[model samples]
Target: MEYVEIARAESERGELVLRERRDENAPTVLELRANGVFVMDTLETSTEQALASAALALVDRPRAVVVGGLGLGFTMHEVLADHRVEKCAVVEIEPRLVDWMRDGTVPHGPALLADERVTVVVADIAVALAEAPPSSYDLVLLDVDNGPGYLVHRTNAALYREPFLRAARSVLRPGGALAVWSADQAPELRDTLAEVFGDAEAQSHDVVLQDREEAFWLYVARVPSDA
Candidate 1:
């Protein structure tokens, strides 16, 4: 296995790096790292794709969606795969990552961002959700950090707390849904989502990564139709 540095940028939060992974026997992969922490990779993105698919499936009208992170654009790409989705607003905190995607530093970045239904907003996702108008979107998918338990940044911990969760809820239209991806089971987050949205469910997705079977969790909650 070998890693070739593709691009690196220093952000206020930390250092962000894009690299190409070349394995002699396996296909090449692109990986993203933040502050030296492995963020995501192009290897198997079943979890990311599942995050978007499950949330969109729960909504009766998933025409407008908000994706909290733009790691490698896999989640965003999955979101756009649904023709029912007319708009996808992606909120990313690091400007350099966005620039890389736009300028082709991240190979699939340009093509993914070029989708007419896609809108990129370089801002803290928490702030973006807070400032958004009530009932602004039909679905909100958060893959910003691994989860509240495995945070890439300490500040992102707030994203799982009550206040920020409420903000995410407020931005959803009635009957809309909010889905959060976790690297591991976060029982507390599921409970919190239940409290905020009146009900929530957790789904486990078993995937094989690097020849190891791992389990990822998705927490989903939907606003009532009459709300």
Candidate 2:
């Protein structure tokens, strides 16, 4: 199978590449890459879906959601699947990524961008989280990089640290949940979430790829209603 380059852009974080690959056994797959590293592909998005579903399940009537990273819009789309979600704020650091999605360069682009309840912010997620008012959202889902261990850019390491987690927590309403999607299990991250949220659990999702079965992780933490 041959992968054709769909588009490329020099993003602030790194070089962003979008490509399409076709296989005889599967439908056309769109892939998103950053700094020459594979971010995600449209073929299988269970981890992203689980990131939204699992988090929303922990919150009651989640009216507002903050999603960090807009990879192919899978996470955002899954969040919008729930009718209870009145506002879905997505923060993407790469402006070109948003442009590609809005311009139909990506398959899942237009619908997500056109959703009335969805707001796409072309800014760093950390900045967005820092500027968010306290108790503003019902949920915060992050899948900015593969995980804290596999960041496309070294600077993104801050997102998975103690301070960033604290910032994310401050933006969530009482009893709101924070969920993060990781390509692999990170016990350290789970530990950090526990330290910040008082409690945290890691949910593992089994995913079947073309050649093998793999697992992803979703770390979830909830704010105390009294806090």
Candidate 3:
């Protein structure tokens, strides 16, 4: 196996690194790391893509969507696939990650950034959600950290708390939905969402890697049209 460094930077949150690695029998893979924690790569993005699809499925006509994290742009790309989505805002804490995408460091980055309906916001997702007007978005998808159990940044833990969840709910219009991606099943997160949204469902998706099968989780909560 051979590894090559692509780019590295320091963000307000922590250290961010991008690299490419190639193996004898496998294709070259681009990986992203934040504060020495492994984030995501280009190997398999089914879970990220599923996050968008599953969330949109719950809404009738989702026009405005906000994605919490913009890792490799897979989630945003998937969100744009639905013609019903007229505006898509992606909030990323690290500006360097967005720069890498804009400069073509990530393979699928250019196309997603080029989309007219997409808006890239370089800011903390929590702040963005808090500042958003009430009932403004049709859907909100969160893929920032790994999950409640594992956090790339300690500060990100607040995002899964009751307060943030409530704030996220407040930004959703009636019948709008909020979706979260977790590297593992998070029962506590499900319960928290249930408390905030009145109901929450956890869906498991399986992705086959080179050596094993991994189960990723998605949590979806919707506001009733009457609410």
Candidate 4:
């Protein structure tokens, strides 16, 4: 495969190096740190799409949506694609990812980043959730790292905990849903969500693009409004 150096590696965290590869098929990403840790790439995004689609299926006439993680903007794109969505806010902890999308390093970056309906907030999503409007957003989609099974940043694990889940629940509108993407089915995560949301579920779906070699986990938790 022929490749061009569209963007070079840069360190956001202590030893984390992020690089973008522009090739004929698509411009993808590579993230590494002190160890040989890798994050994600462009070839696969079934979980991202599934997460967004699942939440969208539950919410109707959603005035806004909050998406955590800007990994290639696949989830953000899916949320914005919905005509019923009036506005969308995306919170990304990594500034480099936002910059990468801003400068068009990856495919469709500019279109997604500059979309009038999209508000890209460069901050930790947990912090953003602290003040995100109450009963404001109909959906909250998070794919910040490798999900509940694997995490890119250690602190992100809190996002899967009760306190953070309650915060996310607070920001969500009644009947709104929070969808988290995981690399593998997490029964523990399912239980955690059930404890926090009072109702939660986990579903597995196979991706046609992955040639059946891959499957995605969709964890949906609903925040019910008081009648």
Superior by TM-score: candidate 2 or candidate 4: 2
Candidate 1 per-residue lDDT, tens place, 113-187, comes to 999999999999988988999999999999999788889999999999899989989998989999998988899
TM-score of 2: 0.95
The root-mean-square deviation over C-alpha atoms between each candidate and the true structure, in angstroms, is 1.2, 1.4, 1.4, 3.0
| lDDT score for candidate 1 against the true structure | 0.91
What TM-score against the true fold does each predicted structure earn?
0.96, 0.95, 0.95, 0.86
Per-residue alpha-carbon lDDT of candidate 4 for residues 84-107, written as tens digits (9 for 90 to 100): 998899998767767877886665
Query: How many residue pairs clash in each candidate at the backbone level?
Result: 0, 0, 0, 0
Candidate with maximal TM-score: 1
Candidate 1 residue pairs in backbone clash: none
The models' CA-based lDDT, in order, is 0.91, 0.89, 0.90, 0.77
lDDT, candidate 2, 114-157, per-residue tens:
99999999888999999999999999998888788888789989
RMSD of 2: 1.4
Better of 1 and 2 by TM-score: 1
Off by over 4 Å in 2: 24-26
Off by over 4 Å in 1: none
Model 4 CA lDDT for position 221:
90
